[model samples]
Target: MARDDRAVGVSSFEGQATSAGQASLAGEATGTASASGPHFAAGPPAETGEPLRHPPHGEGDERAGEVSAGGRGRPSRAPPSLSWLLFSRLVFPGIFLASGLAGLLTLREIVAPPLDMPRILSGLERGGSARAEALTQVHEAILDPRYRDLKADPELAESLIRVLETELRQPITGSPEFTVAYRAQLCRLVRELDTPRTVPVLLIAVECRIADTPQLDSPIRRAAAEGVVTALERHGPDCVRSVPGGVAALCRAAKDPVAPVRAAAAAALGHIGGDEVCDLLREMLHDDTDVVRYNAAIALAYAGRGTGLDTLHEFLRSENVRNLADTGSTESVIGDRTCKLLCRALFALDRLCDRSTEERLAVLHPAMEDLCLSRAPEEVRTLAMRVDLKIERFHR
Candidate 1:
């Protein structure tokens, strides 16, 4: 019986090895065995034969037991646990399936594309119902902060602005929240997209001063003004328009007690200058504050027309007299800025003047020489050289 038991154990070990090898071959072909095969190293046999009893004990029973145990050792096999099988077959496959499904969903969204109002609006009327609906979708998207990140997408930004314009046209009581949210979204879009569409909306927002409530005025108005300035700076003359009340507000801002408001207005006027801008700048040239006058001179240089040259020349001569009177010891930076402004104004005037080449050269030569040779700031020298070169080229 002992010999039979030993033979059976050896046969069981051989059978197990053969089964493992076959399973490995199948796994290599199907790819499933790679993860599961390692676990079978300690797997139990497919069948457990009847238990074998030990030989009867005698005087040398201890020695005999040791010999028998050593000669016919059974292979160690760990019992298969349901938990391990479930993890191997069910849990891992579930994770892979979930990841694949997620990828598919993402691909679907990308291929189908989202609604893009800016592109749609390119072919639709600004005030039409189609545009309004598109804008509404954008407005809804932006009201959530998550859409803020989406602003990086140009199409999304365009849609948001279209919606914002529609909201602006509605009555104030219609949905103040929507109006305010739309303006906020417009502000973000202008800063993010900095496109032409944002320009008109920014101007309208500034002109409307939508934040009538005291609590809302300071932050919202400041942001709107900044947006308008940014739009103009980025897009230049094309984005500028001469709204009836727009110039008036800017003109008032030029004289505002607050220096920043005044500066912003001066910059805006320079950006959108016309006959009206020239007039406003001329009046401000005589302002009580030298700072205001200095800015006015700069604006005049930027917005100047044919007569603008003569007016700036007079200011330059007046500033020269003022500088001489002070003996150049004044701490007021405005005086220095005024001198620079005068130099620029002279340059701008030289560009627009229709005098003979000789006459233009004679008029501009002194200022050009002073700008180059004197300790004038680099900007002044640069502008002077640019003007001089332009004049030379024009004559050529």
Candidate 2:
């Protein structure tokens, strides 16, 4: 998945090479083949069958009436022509060999080696599409075992975070969409690094607002918030709390005007246990956006707070959630997101139910039973049944 995304991200570079290189190669091959092809090489001149005659310099000039041994005046066959030999043995083979090598090299350029990390990090600091391209390579590198330890590179992670901060403040000089995408991708990289040092910067990114462009601001902030969630998951909330203003930053982001940013903040807060975080998440339960509310509920459950039980009950009844499980298409982005959110909710509920009183477990019974018996997708039904079993065990 990362590789496919990186391919798309760097498609501009590949598209340019494809047009120029492949077109030139096509023309070159056509010109060479046509020049040597039978159509271009004229056939021998037609035989008139007349004796060859020339002005006789003298009466006995033997060259005056020259003819072939058959007396048909045909030119005697001679050794193969030099041009033919070169075209047949050298040029023809050379054309194919050159074409093969050219094609191989073109493919090599399109699928170039992963740029070295230092070079990639340098390009990222340079900004613009170079930064976008560099981020793509870094994403691919993270998946590569050779660069898997990238998460541990404290210096590199800090440098990238600084670049991210500087780039976010700069005016949009290129396609705004491209700018937003790279900024989001940069946040994703910080998330991948799983370094606690980036917690402070990630917090700053979540609240950093781009002027007059909610379209741009929302995605970047959402990505930054997700980065915070990833850090908490890896190193725990203590790492974030240690950073001055980190928890406060998240609290502010939980109320971001953008629903996705709010949703991401709820997810991050779920990993932390505290009255403040729970209060914030509980407040978020009333958010207008369905995803925001759902995320807030799931987060509260993660903190072992049952304040989100009603929200989870509501989530189980949502038409969108029910349909998401039944959809046959695997590529639907909404479907994937819904599935993940549903899975998280079920897992959170299952854990939460384990600690609930018998009466509390009874509150969840109807939703769990209905989900298990319904035509929800197999995975959803399976998880719902697990929740039922957990509830049943308490009764037993």
Q: Which candidate is the best by lDDT?
A: 2
Q: What lDDT is obtained when candidate 1 is compared to the true structure?
A: 0.58
Show pairs that collide, candidate 2: none
- Candidate 1's clash total is 1
Model 2 lDDT, residue 322, Cα = 66
Candidate 2 whole-model C-alpha lDDT, 0 to 1: 0.79
Q: What is the lDDT of residue 53 in candidate 2?
A: 71
For residue 376, model 1's alpha carbon misses the true position, in angstroms, by 6.7
What does candidate 1's lDDT look like per residue over 1-396, in tens digits? 999999999999999999888878766665554555432332223344545555666746666566667986444457879998998899999999999999998776556445564555553345456655654565565454544545456665565566656656665555666656655655554555546666656556554445456344333344555566666767775565644455566666566554544555665676677887778777876667654565565565566444334444455446552452345432567656565555546555554543333343435555556555545555655666776666667666
Model 2 C-alpha RMSD vs. true structure (Å) is 28.8
Superposition error at 361 for model 1 (Å): 9.6
Q: Each model's RMSD to truth, in Å?
A: 20.9, 28.8
